[model samples]
Target: MNLKFIKRNIFPLVKIISTVLITSAIGLESWNIYAFLTNRNVPSSLNPIFWIERFAMTSHFIESIIAAFYAHSGKKMPIQYATYTFFVGTIGLLELFDQEND
Candidate 1:
């Protein structure tokens, strides 16, 4: 059980786990919105559609944070790091648009 070998194996595992968790969170958030719309009445003051959009955007923000962490873990190749960084930037832009609408 060399410490270096353990680290080498664990870090990539962590990145994969992080990516899966982020994707799951996005899916769950979307499902929540769908459930709200299909089964319940919408509130008059806050539009359910807009609220769902904002919630989805917030989930993207969380996904961006996960991507940033995975990128900074220093376990991935340069290309992988760049790819995660690009996702983070795209999520941030979506969040900004959501904020502007609210």
Candidate 2:
């Protein structure tokens, strides 16, 4: 119930949850792409999921590029930062910011 404890714990927990959700989504989208490639029958209702995944991937890729640029300018390892950004989204950016600040 302490505010400090909640502040310290809740944000990391949220980040972990978001990372898991994103990873699961990526897995599902990968499966969908595989199905499409293999000519498997996909239900009409699920067709939009592919497009949604595409958009999500595009956005994440762009974010990763931005993170790479930021990392380079910060004299950090760009690929490492970018890979984190690619998989975990803006929480990685937040971590980069915190490290740079330190």
Top candidate on TM-score is 2
lDDT of 2 by residue, 1-102 (tens): 896676488767866876786687788877877888999976778768767867777887898898999996667899988977887777678767777887
For each candidate, what TM-score against the reference? 0.39, 0.73
> Candidate 1: lDDT over CA atoms?
0.54
Instruction: Return the top candidate by lDDT.
Output: 2
- Model 1 poorest ten-residue lDDT run: 89-98
User: Could you tell me the lDDT of residue 51 within candidate 1?
Assistant: 62
> What Cα-based lDDT does every candidate model obtain?
0.54, 0.78
What RMSD does model 1 have?
Answer: 12.3
